[model samples]
Target: MIRTGDEYRESLNDGRQIWINGERVDDPCNHPQFKPVIDIRARIYDMQHDPETQGAMTYEEQGERFAIGLRLPYEQQDWQDKRDAVDLVMNDIGGVVTRVGDETIGEMWSLWDGKDILNEIDPRFATNIERHIHQCIKDDPFHVSANTDPKGDRSKAPQDQDPDMLVHVVRETDAGIVIRGAKYETAAAYSNQAFLKPTIANWGNDKLSDYALGCIVHMNAPGVKHICRTGFAGRAPEADYPLSNRVDEIDTLMILDDVLVPWEDVLFYQHTRAASFIRTTLHRYSAFPFVQRTLSYADLIIGAALWNVKQTGLDKQQAVQEKLSELAIWREGINAFLTASVATAEKSPNGLLMPNQSLLMSSRVHALTNLPHMMHLARELCGGQICVTPDAATFAAPDTKPWMDKFYSINEEWVADDRRKLLGLARDLLNSDYAGHRLTFQLFAQSPPFAQLAAVYRNFDWQGPLEFSHKAAGLSDNVWGKGTRH
Candidate 1:
């Protein structure tokens, strides 16, 4: 059941429609923009089979090996194992990349927990989700998510401006339901499938809507066009933009032009409640891994900032130490949330163990809400040299090499080349275009800031606080009996 790197590489040759920078990608695995990340993803697959990493990255059941990341959780160890696997990958890769597979599979599990809603809406497609969960375990396909349609104008109704702005069931056919719309999906060009569904939380209490549909979208299926944002890999020298070149997860504005979702692939159809249910609980299980990625990212940021200070001998300053403490506070805040979430893990309605919702969601808010500030803090610690530093070419030019060496070299231990490498890493991690794009990705990847807060509001135990306040204030018995309000 386990796949090798070559099998993953060959799987993308399914003639999927992929476009980037106005050019059709003939081979995404070898395309300059996608090749770096594709290779990273392939390496993750290979790591599962490598004797050194196979033990950590995979699990054996009945003498057959399978991806640990794809295993369905039933106990707390399942989650801890997944966490260790993600950490191993981050360490091995030497940087961070999100939307691989583990991060997005939680969306599917969220829906699986809503099977009762699925069954209520349409009995025919109820079992589709359970089947696919097992399919992922068996085939080890790369999965991603599809939500957030480009609702052209929020002021006008979907029908008034353009119905296609939201993905909807155009019509039901003998083969399946035909869908037309576009979604901004990260890694869609390279991923095998996406759990396509609605992102709008408010469905106006309507019973059935064409917009309320969920299905499994095959990336290579007919009419699926992956028009990707221009990638950062080949745009600059790897020496100057190492993280950008190595870990950029390309996003696609995936267009579904009347794509068919066979009955077997449809998870829910024309049911607003199902859509609402999914929109509310989509990140329940996935937020753990999503937040975990932020933890690795925090480490990278902290390392860059600390090393920059150490390079300039500024770490000894009390003021500089204060700034480093602030960064650590943010880092450990994320760490605490993740650790506590796992320790107090809860079971899903369907029997799968998931991280505690309150801590997990609040962790997402804390991590993302303060991300820009923390990134800016790290940026300050790194100093202005990161932004003003020239590319690797200037440092290597024959005439400028001596001058560059004189200015960049710090001491006996830190030479010009090493200094340039550190500055390059700091620049790419904090100040580059890729850095800004990634910041935005983390901000809204799971959902928007407002939605993230809403999740926290929904999951948090407000009753406990209210009860405590009520007791402290010596509220009347009448009010104490009511849940949150009299």
Candidate 2:
């Protein structure tokens, strides 16, 4: 069933424990740090009912409406509709948000594509996956992902050191398995559920171990505790820090202290191969939406810089134009990869259409690897004025209003108020604490750089280059390894 904004808000009051800044949070819907982003999520829900946006935000099947983001992809049009829905939501909210439901739901689809592997362990596991995928469509609950574990020491194994460092099944009850560990999850505080799974690990030759697990975790379950990191919202003035105030998604150190996972919620367990398969293929479908967020961020940065250069009359300079061209080239490079991946979409093992892995992984690398450089270029284009500009209160003060107006006003068309607004946006986008968090989130949110490159290495067609070199060089058949990827 489709949920409205009020239903989504009311769902959060289901006796979930939340903590921020060392104080217990009674209600996230009204808390300062959580309210702004919560309202954005609620607005997204309300969009599905609005006359103007309901078309793009939802789809009808058998005369009933459901969220388009939760719809299973059977064709390319489904993907396009999902893309259009995400774009509409970001535009409606006026900023970028990464961890709402759509981006993480594809992770479950990835695991679903590995049903045969899961079936080999237990047919019930595969059936559980199938049931949950549809159940999400029926429930319309806000789902997030939980992957990274605290993993106390790299050199010591879970058996040797603190076993709780990595999430493991303590024992199996008649009801389910009891799990004890913690995961770093984004948006877990206010989210309804999380697709919990293991991080990359050295499974060696073991096929069955306690460390291998995947399940659906209810956010308000008995032993789940959300120890949230300090939020950027309400700590600073919104007038000077706009994006931080509105769009910062609060992350959490979600402590799963002897939590019980019922048999119905368990997707897979005690199977190293299943864990390895999921670790490899987890982001195959999800990266599309994740990379799309980068594209929107590119537009925000470019718009900020273009406005800044225009205000300073630097748009006329050839050198300034070259810098802007560089930003555009990087932005379009991301766009090209995203477009081409879908143009040559591949069918998954389970018959779901997935973006081309090679192009998608390459796009993620291109978007993230050069993000710091692109951010620096945009910072240069926005100029030093973003840093030196006075805050909103300083501009409003009677003692300084005249001098601020005289210096900041560029022409009859440009005034102090507009100039300061632009500077605030530019600073928040490129120079603020939120900017650093955003950059880090892109860098390692999905996985680290080496893992991303490994994905490209695994998916790229090495045989094409190998065969081409063998024919071009007229090498013997024995030299090329007979169509095998190197």
- Best candidate, lDDT: 2
lDDT of each: 0.91, 0.93
Model 2 C-alpha lDDT per residue in residues 358-401, reported as the tens digit of each score: 99999999999989999999999998888888899988899999
- Clash count for candidate 2 is 0
- As a TM-score, model 2 comes out at 0.99
True-vs-predicted CA distance for residue 1, candidate 1, Å? 0.9
- The 10-residue segment of model 1 with minimum total lDDT is 199-208
- Model 1 agreement with the true structure over 230-342: per-residue lDDT tens digits: 99997899999999999999999999999999999999988788888899999999999999999999999999999989988999999999999998999899999999998
> TM-score of predicted model 1?
0.98
Check candidate 2 and list the clashing pairs: none
Residue 14 lDDT in model 2? Answer: 95
TM-scores of all models? 0.98, 0.99
